[model samples]
Target: MSDKMKKGQGPADEEQNAQWVASRSLMNVGSLDESGYLNSFYRQGYNLSKCLSESFANAKDAGADKIVFEDTESYNRIIDNGRGMSRDDFKSMFSFQKPNHSDRKSCGISGIGGKIAQCILSNKKTSTTYTFNGDEYLVANAPWDRMFEYGVFSDMITIDNMNQYQIDMFNARTNGNTGTIIEFPRNDDVIDVIKQNFSRNNKDDKQSKMECVYNPCDMINVVFGGFRLDISYKRRDGEVEQMQMYDYFGEESEKYYDGKTTRTIEHYYDARKDISRYILKADDVQDESDMEIPRVGRGYSKDPRKVSAPYEGYIKKGEYVAVVGQRHYTDMDEEPPETIIQCYDDRKKCFYDEQFEEGISDHRAPLYRNGQMIGKFHCSDVKYTNSRANSKSYHEIKSVQLKLSYSTHCTQDNLLDKCMGIQQNKNQFQSEDMPVNLTRLLGYIKKDKATMIYKYFESIRTQPISPSQPSEVEQPVSPSQPVELRQSVEDSMTQRSVNGYVTGPLTPIQVTIALGINIGDLTLETLTRLGKDRHIIAMFNAVNK
Candidate 1:
């Protein structure tokens, strides 16, 4: 053949050579430095619990009923009896922020939860994944450190066999079951970083840390944040030992629940088009008094002329029902000053109380979407201005802690589906899409329920003396007595002094003065007799000038 003809080569040979070059280039792309993308996109709130929760969620999604968290001398392992990933799934695991499966019922919607967990918890460049697929056990070694350093997804290695060490551990722990084991080499740095980020300095942070505890044996009655977490493991000698993880809240004060109220709200609204709707079923058991569940469609109406008319545009517009019950803990003697409202999804994933800061103007009743708490809302349907004191939204959320359970049925075709504004984290409802009319209805329900609760407690407080006991008589105060004596007698009858300071019973004039206004017309005695109601306090401040 001529020299030119030989150099040109056969068409088949040229195509093969080009294909090889393209394959090499794809490999190079896999190995490129991904640190920028990882840092910018994947570095979410890096807490140990978040990492562990994600791991648990992954296990649960994979159909794992039993999970074991073991810390060994060489590495930390999260072993689960879930169906192990296939080769394709194993490779797809490294894809950033992209989930292979989108199951609405699962806690891990974004597939990056595990990746984020692993990146934040592992110090080394590699993590070992061992999965069994019936006939053979497969091992995939992910070079995550190298991926972060070189910025490529191609450094991972997979094989059909495990090293002697892995085999031994698998035999000892899983007894050769078909499952998945994720191993991260012991890294104190990762642990330290997690602790630093999750330090319990605030109420929300403390609550978040508490929400991470999981018990594999009892999935239904899992406690969120608590004083103790029991972990069971086999000792070197083969005896099983149970250990506890303690001091989860550090220095934060622990809350005790004396009463609980479980409420179920089921509502649906159709405004020509399906405007907004919900079907809620909750069991509240946290209050000392009996709950008076309002009539669903008809009882909420206020018009005397239309007594039978459904509470206009409220629960009447749709098919709604709620069953509420309250119970006080018999062990507790006195009511707790502050009530605790804990919100959980159907999956038992706890929504942190902090999520309520947004959208919930007063944080009275936390909002829920498909069982996960989106946020909290004011008890009343009023908005407030800084100078106006009370535009109706100002109420202490802690006064009545309630577990509001409901589910949203917003399909792809529903208007609510178009407006359902859930955040990527699934922790909050976007305020822009929050249905005001629905919220107002809920607020009305909670407010009325809370009023009844207060009234019940007030009745208890003002119970008349038993007929068996002799009633005490009060002598009238003489006007001739010294001003201080007369004032002191009246104060003793209405208010009590704790230490040297008078506690309450502030009069309108006193409220005005307390609100930084000089009430020139009223006497100090009259001002001192006013009750410390929030509305009165607000009115005092508003009209003080």
Candidate 2:
């Protein structure tokens, strides 16, 4: 071959060349032994359930509520899938100090050992995961396991008799095919997530559960692939319906779940367009075609995230929440994943600080209190970017800007308009055809209001009373003192007395004024034009003067 041809890459040479280039990094330093790889899972902190709940919460907010919410049978299996650390995936999902997982590949990798993504909810609430994996593989990282066992995964002891989802999954994956079964025995603490966000179904059974607890590999897919996912909670009775879908790792999902299957991008975008209604519409997105869901195939086609939450912002509009700061690179590194949460703050008249977060492993879409973060943005999976960690060459950081808008309960930026609990203008106050969106807005509000209403009456029940109870019809007091006992009578007397003082139309206040000219010469019509609050006050003061 000529020198020009030799210098350029051939298909075969490029493959070897790419590996050589990848090997230059520290990722190629040394591979981990099998035992060392298993030790990584031991480092995952307690409160795995809390992390699972946040994943569900975030997924629900972005309109995936329907596809993921589950019952105990399906939820547990998904949890197993997320917590799973097979010999194939990373040696440790949370930490970067893996012996087997090297920086040879250009994929994102982290070595600093911390699990902000999986352990955040522990500070917020207690967590529990119920699965049918015979508890043998039902790994748990609870409080007692931690104080005594250190930062190791405390495996649960179990009998195979209680396994329901496992049996179902085994049936589905009979022979060579492989499938998973997960169940959620209880209502997740993050029910507000779906209540505030998305839904897939109301009362459907028999269909297999669609969500997993979100293990680190899944985290890799979600963080590196831009995958919108969530952890689901399913139960036996129809109590926990299949209303929402996917466990979100907040913004850095599409980077991780960008799996390569026998799927065409053109077909994927086409199907996304056809099912645009099933997909979601956001305001920030202008060219809907430009919004490409990188990976597709097998799942998500039968069920996808629901467009059930209201769009962000009051009708006035302007402030927007868009995803920015991409940490995923095609090259290898030992850096952690991080991103920015950009939103306009009208009061500050500018954007919030250039914030760097560990990144969300789940969606709690900018948790709001009267529409603001109570303390600080909960950053998950955060690590600083570095070009030096793996000693690889040609490292670059690019901020991927996305036209952002939510596809649930509302829409903006050319996406589809979502359905809120309120009826549309056409339907006009009729809830008949109107679908009740997720419970985030009015549901949570109504629940709080209902609690308050109940407590008010309950307080009345607990109040002190006379030992003798009055009969329903019998008089409790004599006619004279009865007036005090008759609440309605006292109210009527007061209203009647006020009515005597003010019965007719509001009486116009009579005032004599010297408008610097003369009130005597001024006509009512002339006075109307000059009537300002200040002028009126001046006229009244002048009259008094």
Candidate 3:
């Protein structure tokens, strides 16, 4: 054999006499569809909220430590005291091909987020002023909306193109020379959305005014690298009101129990897997009075038991925490059928659910991705099983905020892939594996550790009031009921229960058939108000025997 062959390079490598032939196939290059290109930006789930979120992300990426949001009848503005953009940097915002920020801490995945936000808000009429060193301030106006309307995307900007109005607005809003100010023409819809989502009743106000819900100093250790955010809005009476930025993490964390005490689970990283996990579990359960009083703003609710339930979970994967807790299966019974809020007006609905409620507390911890709130953290592995009928040892995890944090050469590519999984607008996650891994992380607790953690939380609950000692949960399945019939009944009950039908009174077996759906679905009011028919009564009687 040839030396090259012996070395695993193959005999072909030694064929110096061989002449290589090159072949090519010709294909037509298609023309760009300008309309479709413009439409693609809108399709990415950008609404007023997401646009604002992108603005904040841009500021954060620029190393901004302080951000201010201003809303008035004339215009809306976002001013950030960060390392402001240079002229080239400002120009890049208009480029379709400009790459997203490569910084690991940056939320700029698509270079076009800021541009798209501008076009969506002001169309072609957008104004921005930026300075790199607080020395020479430059203001530029881009016709982004017009570019979309004409299907002619342009990145060219003149450094001296500021008009008198733009100059005045820029000077009025800009403070330090080393900062950026983004302004778009007044958008009433945007203003209204800000008020709706960010406002909360202030108990201290004699006139019962709603204040902004943000707490700037809260959760500084984690989110946005601890940036300070301030917000102001012009009231209808021409008075300016300063509102606090909504503090999703801090408020949601404390409210896990009594809105007073929270248990912080230290960070956990699996070096073997190159993944990091963090959790904030509720240390104590709510007392009776705590459950009945509804505070204002997010996480404020009367009957938190009905709102969040005993052991429910919530996941947040976007800019803000959801206003309502997980829809209580128990409260549905007492709630009048007519009172159930649906998206009556189709126009009011966006890609995300927007039904606002009084409270932020939920049975589960809100989920976050890279510090932004997303969705709920759920695990099928932590559930009760018929095989372990006598054991109540399943992890009673109150709420968890799961995120991905990894810093390693081998895992950098994996993190890149995870970043790509985020949708263009960054509203929610589309990655299938991302969630599966997070779910596995939830089960990372060792059997002993799980027991220890549960006992610790139980001790906290016992401090305020005596909780009933847990006895072995009786097996819910009845030996008399045919296994096949019971399975069929379980399936039927599950489907019916989901559609809001009351399950017949089948007792332990029914409970065993569906743990979450059965207890959550069946309420005293539902039992009396709905399932009184003879068919249900007969089934109920049949199952008990």
Candidate 4:
């Protein structure tokens, strides 16, 4: 540092400077622009309803037992009686890098979930008042107007800045000093943008209750249907509406079954796996006279909306529904398996009954992390052709139209580990176990002869009723009405009918094709042995009759 060390420079300083320059030369340093990042995130399939979900998730994490949503003509407010934050935590809410929660059972893992809501919905000037443990009240103001101007939300204020009037209002709304209130002015531009992205019709018509809360399905769809907290919405008209777990939202034109009965079955927790399974069973008696295959109806078109009832599909006499859920207790130590398989039904969309809509999707089961729904899970990675209602996989899942529901929770106190990787914005999560879970669920239906699913399939296989009530006496098929029996190997086999029944050896493929039995693991010899089964023979004969 002779020329460079004219001042107070040492050999150690020169060596350190050389290393720094060498390191800088070898690597290209890059940084993320907050404004550009946010703009790009919004453009890439980011659902605006997620803003509402993120807020609800934060409220739930704070152990809020009640949440109130109020939408007025000029502003929208959310009030919650949760354990509000301290001054330091309140200020951090506006920071781009928010702190991650320590509760493993939390619905939010990404630290930015709460901040996203504040950033995306903070129009003009936003004020948030909160009190922790019945202590002094504090308020923070976010001047979002300066967000893009400076490409940062740094110019925000957080302190015990609430006036007497603001404190009184907060106490009035929350009924307690330990609570939080977030209020923002109504921005029609943001609302219209959300509507244009999510609405099926995308028309700028008058807002309905379904379209009121940013048009993400409805208020009910904003959160998990089975959310434990008491949620109430104060309408713009001043009418307060309470939301129940299983409120039916069907239209008048849609069909409703009055004969459905529901029962909950709590499964024993596995000590080794630390998982508990719960079943919500919905059963209905089928009327043979009304036996009609489920078909896609109107209201699904692009132009004129003629909404049809969801799940107008056939109802078996006594079959179980399907819905799946899970909760995490401890952190995940190991990486998920690399192989991921999913199932799909691309033909038409399937909506669930209100009782089982903890989550909903077109076809795949809703995938939930902790209590929050992140995405959907399929049976296989590749799309399975469901055009044939008689396909083994499709019929097994669709015949009963079962809404399979199960949940898992952790009792310990580890927050760093997680069973799933919930991606940013929460559109998806790492679901490596989904395929295995779905396959096991289907196996439970087939392997357990004691299950109603087994009994229902057995009923269909053994008896061939011709639009008549089932009877003990097996009557001959009516010659006037001949039902064609289809085969899986239609090209390789011939169809023959004798004595109102098909008399032939039932191959494994034929059994799977005709009776929807999975024969992947069974050998030809194993299937030949099953052909001797009177029930298998009866199933084959019943189909032709």
Which is the leading candidate under lDDT?
A: 4
Candidate 2 on 322-388: residue-level lDDT in tens? Answer: 3322223332232111110000000011111111112322122221211112111211221224312
Q: What local distance difference test score does each model get? A: 0.44, 0.27, 0.44, 0.45
Model 4's number of clashes is 21
Error of 2 at 502 (Å): 38
When 2 and 3 are scored with TM-score, the better candidate is: 3
**Candidate 1's residue-wise lDDT over 1-545, tens digit each?**
54643565423457775675676564544543455656643445445545665565567656676666665667777787877777777776766556555534444444566776776667535777788756566787767777666665544555557778777777676777777888888766544423332232222565545543232111111111221223344322444444322211122222212122334444445565444444333334333222222334633222111123243464322222322222332223443211111110011111332322222113344444433334444433444342123211122123334434344342233333234454444334455555544444455455545455544543343332122322232332334545565455445423322111344555554433333334553432332332222333233333332
For model 4, what is the error of residue 423's alpha carbon versus the real structure, in angstroms, after optimal superposition?
0.8
Candidate 4 segments whose C-alpha is farther than 4 A from its true place: 1-32, 37-45, 123-132, 188-223, 246-362, 381-388, 391-395, 399-421, 430-452, 456-545
What digit string (tens of lDDT, one per residue) describes model 3 on residues 142-260? 66666666776644344554466655656665553467787778777777655654453233443233433332211111233223555455554566655543333333322322122
On lDDT, the stronger of 3 and 4 is: 4
TM-score per candidate, in order?
0.51, 0.24, 0.52, 0.53
Question: What value does the lDDT take at residue 344 in candidate 1?
Answer: 6
Alpha-carbon RMSD to native, per candidate:
14.4, 24.2, 16.8, 17.8
Off by over 4 Å in 1: 1-36, 42-48, 64-68, 81-92, 95-104, 133-136, 154-164, 175-179, 189-396, 404-420, 426-433, 464-545
- Measured on C-alpha atoms, candidate 1 has an lDDT of 0.44
